[model samples]
Target chain A: MIGVGKVKQYSNVLDKPLSKGKQEVSLSAFAFLFSELVQYNQTQVDNIAELERRLEDAGYSVGARVLELLCHRDKGNRRETRLLGILSFVHSTVWKVLFGKVADSLEKGTEHEDEYMISEKELLVNRFISIPKDMGTFNCGAFVAGIVRGVLDSAGFPAVVTAHFVPIEGQQRPRTTILIKFAEEVLKREARLG
Target chain B: MAPAGPRSGDAIFASAERVNAELFTLTYGAIVRQLLTDLEEVEEVNKQLDQMGYNIGIRLVDEFLAKSNVSRCIDFKETAEVIAKVGFKMFLGVTASVTNWDADGTCCSIVLEDNPLVDFVELPDTCQGLYYCNVLSGVIRGALEMVSMKTEVTWARDMLRGDDAFELQVKLLKQVPEEYPYKDDE
Candidate 1:
């Protein structure tokens, strides 16, 4: 058992800065577990879309909490504002908090000032995702989309988040990109800010 | 009123890394067992699993915010750093790297390493080339929305093509009102 002092120190240290300590888990375990989840959902899935939706919904819940925990730990209990600014925060901060790395790229919409993109060369989900021949149209990335939607929705960024597969050749893992489309009012605000 | 970003001293990762992983596994096991318990309709069990994940996401949002300590993101760079250091480390025990940075620095790409979650997991013959770890994406999307910044997450490729790498693209969509309604509009 850990002593009170050690626990306090752990709490204090982790509470403030961003930590990069080594922690490992079993991929097979997660895979088997998730497999069961997919299998269970498939039975009730009226269609491929429905099955994916269920998965997305599940992820959405996790996204909500993931966003909160990360922000709380880094900011020491402060909330952020600024639409484009916060999105970048999510691309980097939130991504790191959940997947353990800052995203590969963060892009802004050249045509629409209110729009932006967070790009990663390798998504954590696709790292070991293997779709079966039967479920051809199924892309579990929707689960990720749901999580993004949930996070943004919870944070007051009422927008739609969709997960798509943008495959790039020569890359070992699938390159998945999440597209975020902001509401009209949000664009208006960005225009005014400029 | 809610506290401003980074000011409340709320970002604290109190759980031990090992314990946290165990918690996720335990939760996974429990969810699976419950679903398989009755040998009843699979749909019902799946629904239950989704509901369970939703509940977990809701709670995780609060926990993530409290641990990250990133009250406010002044700009994109700071936001990215926070994700790499605080966000990823706290939950997954790995930090992604930034690659292919745009000249203006407004855009950049992230690379992930040391992913224990993906280590040694083989997809069953039925699901040959699908990503099983998309739960992270869902969790992230749901969590970020709570604090604002309408966003979307997508995959960059199909993982079945013997491709050892995968990517996720994030796009910024809209800005939600600070006092926005939590419930969906009919």
Candidate 2:
């Protein structure tokens, strides 16, 4: 037996109450941890697509939990029922909780009725990340896209979320446009129900 | 060597940019929960966390140096002070107190009053042997290793495990000699 210690036990962590008071954490710690996450995934993948897929998979789990927690905390435990409502929830409430700011704009796709975009001037996840040239077309924002996908999927609005880098002329930082394309069934259901 | 003047932990915390603690605490909680479910073995989860923290530490040290702008430490005693005062404060927004130095002054313990990672954490009965916060030890070991200081870090006490305070003991093993990786000599 191990010596010189008291045997201590406590109830499960889930049993504890989540506090409503706002608390802050160090951003540098997160950036460094995220940088390491990206680096770790890079070593496991043979191509950029695979790496992005890994990151999305990682973020997917987080998205599912965050959706439940955020709804509980902010919406009086009420889940969003409408398409626009959920999108707005994601763009405003979810973004604010995650990034400390609202997204720049939410726009519908010009050519596609089922497509929408949420644009951010600078993604918090990519603040300190510098993608190397060797890893072509790899954006760490894929993780955020996965989170968006997870939230939408959990809320019964099935959609595909992808992050794209769209540079604006006047903006100092490259803008990230999260393209969300809903499933055909969703559009059909919205049309019939609304 | 005599201990240096006590540094203000609040000063370092006030100057850093902050993120919502929920974003960090919840994300980490999810990761740990996922690991517990996927790995099923508490020991394996601890190992994975340590490995991940090691990877984070090697890269995090560069950021720490750039932001803190502190030079090389004079001795192991000073190293412990910097880590307790600047390292923990800058990263976690909490300052640890350095205490319980060994007679040789090569080992010390850092006592942390608050830990963001374990804000809502509890050690389940099934995870009896698991060290939930082993990542902190790994980060300490990994970061110090990079600076040519081979040190062993272990949890002396954990608040999540019903301890009064979160304490980590760091023992200086030896200083690693510098080596030139790409030297060309016949």
Candidate 3:
């Protein structure tokens, strides 16, 4: 319905709808593209950390865009301002929109008030990827971590976000956990909000 | 209701396992942005994107063959139609139109009115020379090559560069003659 009454053609994308997120491509298409992203970055970097950083950086821009788009489209432009509010938004809203479900768990770090973790068993990006033994602890969850960071940073809750694999005693596949530590200013502001 | 016939692209797409378009859209954006930062040259990023697409295309053609059920012996004209109509629709959820053939039946233009790749994308001033959708061309080339049809695909128009539509000029270079079942040599 963009440029509804106007005669202008090639209506601006700003007027274009999000199509209610109904538009889709096959999951394999996304998986193949993502695998290419990983392979392409692997060729560009010398070390695992750098590779993860590159992937994270790629995901950050996505996170930023997701935050902006979802806020405008889903929230009617009202943003999350509190710590728990923003965290819940990321855990439930962002996760659901991007991955088709809420993250498996969101838990606060027992040792620190400012740190939290969002863990997913079989994270979507990691579902089809099996890191070679030689790659040494490289988790594709770094991309998801970057996404959470991007969302938090843009929504005024700056945090240090990193992805780690936490091994379970019985299971062969470890779960990926995104650990987020809020910045001092964010904590201060949250304290005041309370 | 599993009706078996010539399945429309929409039916195949609707039945396939799906994900949010925004996830795909934003992920691609992030890849482009990261490429621009790391490669530091728009041309290199475009080349890399094309190469990545080529790799993906060769692999995806198998899935395409299995799902679309396109006949293997179709002529180049029908191939272009399949690519523009079925191929694009099945993978990208958008249909492209074939146009402007030069009467040889070996070359034509594919015009896309809606491209998911360019959604919410505006080319920055620094990337004026970038073929933002170079990957699409590479995918066409690679996928065609897999079927033994060599092709040259280039951007004729790009909406990101202010063109009204996205167009790819596809030229069929050669079709390798398929010889099978161990030909007996003299």
Candidate 4:
């Protein structure tokens, strides 16, 4: 019987000779599956907010576990502090851990000094997100936000993250902006430490 | 140590980036299928999810507690607040604030300023009149219960409105056993 621990080992036994490279997968399957997942969750909940909360929780589990595993892998040496340090970690470490590529853009919030925005143009979760007019409440990109939140908080960067779709008229794909706002205490602490 | 690839090496341990999105979807599908096979009733599905989340929450508390080196919350009231700010933020990227702290201040309302999962896309037509997804409510309820705090999750806004934001209210229902229930299982 294979347990959760063995699942990783099993992959190696079957594939043999694992190498580091990009693996292409069918976007259709994920889209369809996510579509159904939303459908399934819909039947069980009472409202749209509930559904989004459910999806957020689902992503939350991934974030929590992923954060644990990633920290274990990285040897958990130093904790992250300050905005730029954490952003770099998100861009290089968390992005590499989850999406394989560094995000397309990492910009500080122009309006707010404390807020930093991490934008991804070709987000995998949003590739097939089709918000129906009737059910105007759902966004699949919350999963990515969960992951980011997980990684950042795990690394000791306390922040609030929000996902939004900012459409660029000429841009081919939707640009997702993850607004990360660090806690005031965190900023204060960073200043003291720096 | 060599870096792990998606297919080979310790994917989680090696920080592999080559993971195929399809495989992640497949994993999600497999877990849901497994759950479905064991559970039939809609209520049962929700129950199982809560049960599973309860277990996860117990373990998660241990991890977070260890990493943050945070002392146990002074009370379940504090525990609920911590979960919303720290627990939710750590995993979901959204910090739910206490919009309506109860008269007793035990039950609190949490407002979700941003949700990452629903970033670019929108829920389709078929899912209307139904709760978008409530696994989170079940999870929070279950996890807090495990930690000895009874809580119920309610939505502040309906998602069908195409409103720019989403919010949820968590009501503390009862005080749970002081000792976590899942401790013996591990």
Which is the leading candidate under DockQ? Answer: 3
Q: By summed lDDT, which 10 consecutive residues of candidate 3 chain A come out lowest?
A: A1-10
Can you tell me which runs of candidate 2 are displaced by over 4 Å?
A: A1-10, A170-173, B1-6, B29-45, B69-74, B120-129, B159-164, B176-186
Q: State the DockQ of every prediction.
A: 0.03, 0.41, 0.50, 0.04
What would the per-residue lDDT of candidate 2 be over residues B1-186, giving only the tens digit for each residue?
555433554665678888877677656765566567767999898887788788777877887777776767888998898888888888888767888898999988988766778765667789877778877888888899889999888889877777767789999999988888776873
**How do the predictions measure up, each by TM-score?**
0.47, 0.85, 0.90, 0.47
Q: What does DockQ come to for candidate 4? A: 0.04
Residue pairs clashing, model 2: none
Worst 10 residues of 2 chain A by lDDT: A1-10
After TM-score superposition, what is the CA distance of residue B12 in candidate 2 from its true location, in Å?
2.7
Tens-place lDDT digits, model 2, residues A1-194: 11222323346656667667377778977776676567666766799998788778777776787788888888889999888999999999888988899999999999999999999888999888777778767788998898898899999999988988888998776788899999999999999887
Model 4 C-alpha lDDT per residue in residues B124-174, reported as the tens digit of each score: 443343333344555577556656677777666633335434556788777
For model 1, the stretches where C-alpha displacement exceeds 4 angstroms are A1-24, A109-115, A133-137, A192-194, B1-186
The alpha-carbon deviation from the true structure for residue B56 of candidate 1, after best TM-score superposition, in angstroms, is: 20
DockQ for candidate 2: 0.41
Query: Cα lDDT of all candidates, in order?
Result: 0.55, 0.80, 0.85, 0.56
lDDT of 3 by residue, A1-194 (tens): 12122322345667655558767777877898899889988988999999999888888888998999899889999999999999999999999999999999999999999999999988989988998999998998999999999999999999999999999889999999999999999999888878
Candidate 2 is scored at a TM of 0.85
> Over the stretch A19-92, how does candidate 4's per-residue lDDT look in tens digits?
22233323332443455556556766797767766665566555655555445546365545556877887777
Error of 3 at A5 (Å): 16
Ranked by lDDT, the better of candidates 1 and 4 is 4
